[model samples]
Target: MIKFAFCYEHDDTLSFVKNEVQNCLRQREIEISVLCCHNACELAQRAHSGCPDILFCDLEQDDATLRSAIMNVKRANNRLICVSTAASHSAHAEDILLEPLYRMPALNRKHLWRYAALAYEKILDEPASFTYYVRPSYLRVPVHEIRYFASEGRRTHIISADCRDTFYQKLDVVEDLMRHKNCRFMRIHKSYLVNASFIAGFSRDYVLLTTGERLRISKYEYYQMLTNQLKSLKNTKLRYHPSYSEW
Candidate 1:
């Protein structure tokens, strides 16, 4: 569910904007909560407490003060999508906001609905492509091309299909970063992190990659992996063969 906070100066247009946004989200079967704030300070306070997914603010007020308040709110919650509504604004305001500003004469259902749809797309869509920056020349390497990472002293070697690159980074730090960013790297050993997508098979103490590379795996981790694989295969079989229940 997406939560939205609306900060506008005019009291009369508040209901209109709220209803339009609600209706737009309802049509898409998305649940949302909307909070209305009369001023920037109120908006910032609400954002600091609720950490809303999106914030819509009126930009017709004192530009300097409003921008500063918005920046504070953004700093408090980096994930909040801050949007500005203004009929006209100076280039300086645009630079300050940094995000796209909606310019409309009056708040209407159609325009607000379009903006809501756009926000949904921007936040929810995930791209399949992944890249890692190699140091020195700083070349962008596609993550899918890499098979595994092996720790060699202070430097980590990236084994890829085409070429190998060496970078100075801890294995654990790279594993955490990749996992947080939705990469398929899994740490199966103390000194190695293998991409799960490229894993062809596994045994008691080793993992076989699609490239025919055998990587060492701890006995405990290998058992854990085997259990997880069995559970997954059982679930798949149950889903496909409902009547054949014998495991």
Candidate 2:
């Protein structure tokens, strides 16, 4: 069974996306629980109690409002995978999924189903480690060890804290592969795929990687990154660590 919760301001758009989502899930014979929220407060309450596996949010709202609502939901359900219905170009965050709502003509029912399936697969078959075959060697990389990936012509560079390797693969293909395995890799640019954990800061033109590399980002990407950062910071306080004491 898959549970979904939606937060949207416009009722018509909400109905459209929800119907698409429900129809696809039904085809797969998956039982679903749909919770509709009109405001951030309602969304937060549902998140706290229902803890839906997937959260779909409308990005048409004001930045401040969306940020607040996203933060509230994250606080309640840290594990929830959020999908956005706007800002198509930004791969700013790891947890929040971005799907262009305006491009509904291009994104048909099949695309929506694929998106839902991807989210479902992440929840069901998340892997702790990912293996990639570098040209001369095979590396079994831990999901947490990856920092980012950069595409160079026909090769892709795997950048991490300990090592960097180049492999023959396209950025999009690599993105899908990692995503299927539940790795938090966001495509910040056409040539760059970034790990959300390594994003130090970002501006309208660029994203500052933790390693001091500034990667170019589109305007939409910047907005998405900003929203993601806000949600992450808000939920940081709720994250627990066994090694650290509360005091």
Candidate 3:
């Protein structure tokens, strides 16, 4: 069973998103454990003990929760992926509420399908990390933990969460490695190669991230490519088969 945590500050919004997430998983016949916490740090602590897989939240209300939760998970050396009720966000009264990756774009009710896709992708038992050489030992990070890769002069920075690690490498080499693993990343600028799934939305001048940070868009081709890829996520296929009993 996959484990999911929803840390929230409001109730109605939480219910809406949770129900949608549940429906999406039910369609795929995947079993999940749902944990609700108000404070993300506590959520992370419990998640660490349980090796939790996914986190869902309302970004507007849970920024503090999300920040602390991310830190706790990081300190425990675990990965936490959040699904917010922002990809295609809509202003809703307390009466209405709802709910990942590339397809979400803003935290609107209509984007939960893409959210499910991200959740399933994270749960799949595939090779899920990127490895970079670090002298005697290498750093292996789960692909989802990576936010973006930036190349500055002679060094490259692997930025994730709130931390940045620098190493000697070229952006082209990193892009090649991502492609080799079938990881979907897009180059919005010559210096920034971003994970497509983390893309919130974009304007002609900038690409917005779920984290509320903006990166400049240089090449229109990559932006167009990313748009096409996100459109395709709507057709994302989900597969899982349970064993049959031999009597």
Candidate 4:
């Protein structure tokens, strides 16, 4: 079962996205849980309990709710996928929908539900795919593409070597998917959760990724990562590139 939660200010928008998205998903036999939140803190609390798979919101949610919700989501799930209905000043959450409240088309619940299901289907089909729940919807993304997720203040960003595509997802969703896929993602820093496959080499204090991204490797788990990496490669048919040093 794929669970979902939606946090939005307006009742109408909430109804529209959830109805459309969830219904579409049902035909495929996916289960979802939807919640409507009026306060940011309330939503944050939900995230802390266990971040949902997807989080769709009106970025224009009252300043206080927006701020608190953003913070809560980051603390709980940094890779969460967010679909914004308004242009939010919130640094971490990005704008997904193009138009503002009045200018946007009427919220279509059916459409949202179908998209939700389609997204899930994609996840189930991909070997590297994982699932997460938003309040009213569920989301899935490829894990290998993610370099790391970091939080700053109340905002968080999904960092990847391909700066051209900074895919945004609710932090909670990221955590959920991480658990389901059983991938090698580690919360190395308070602000960072990294994919182990990207790691090229490591020492007690830091890790070097093939992408050339240097990540802090805590002394507590550095050796464990080395062991895990070795095991990860044991079953694979690995071949060295010409540039790879022959050890």
- Give per-residue CA lDDT, model 3, range 21-90, as digits (tens): 8887776565688877766666766776674567776555535446655556544544445565443344
Tens digits of lDDT, candidate 1, 10-53: 77777777778888777756678888887767776777667666
User: Which is better, 3 or 4, measured by TM-score?
Assistant: 3
Tens-digit lDDT track of model 2 for 1-247: 6678877777876787789888866665566889988777787666667677777775544456556666665566565666664455553452243221221223356656656655654455346565555434336677667888899987898888889888766688667767654445667778888776676766667777767788887668545764564455444432221111110
Highest TM-score: which candidate?
Answer: 1
TM-score of each: 0.48, 0.46, 0.43, 0.41
Error of 4 at 19 (Å): 2.2
Regions more than 4 Å wrong, model 4: 60-64, 86-106, 109-115, 118-247
Cα lDDT over the full model 2: 0.64
Model 1 accuracy (lDDT, Cα): 0.63
- Candidate 2 stretches with Cα past 4 Å from truth are 88-110, 128-247
* Count of residue pairs whose backbone atoms collide, per candidate: 0, 0, 11, 31
Find the 10 residues in a row with the least total lDDT in model 2: 238-247
In candidate 4, what residue range of length 10 has the lowest lDDT sum? 238-247
lDDT winner between 1 and 3, please give it.
Answer: 1
Clashing residue pairs, backbone N/CA/C < 3 A, model 1: none
The list of candidate 1 runs beyond 4 A from truth reads 93-97, 100-106, 127-247
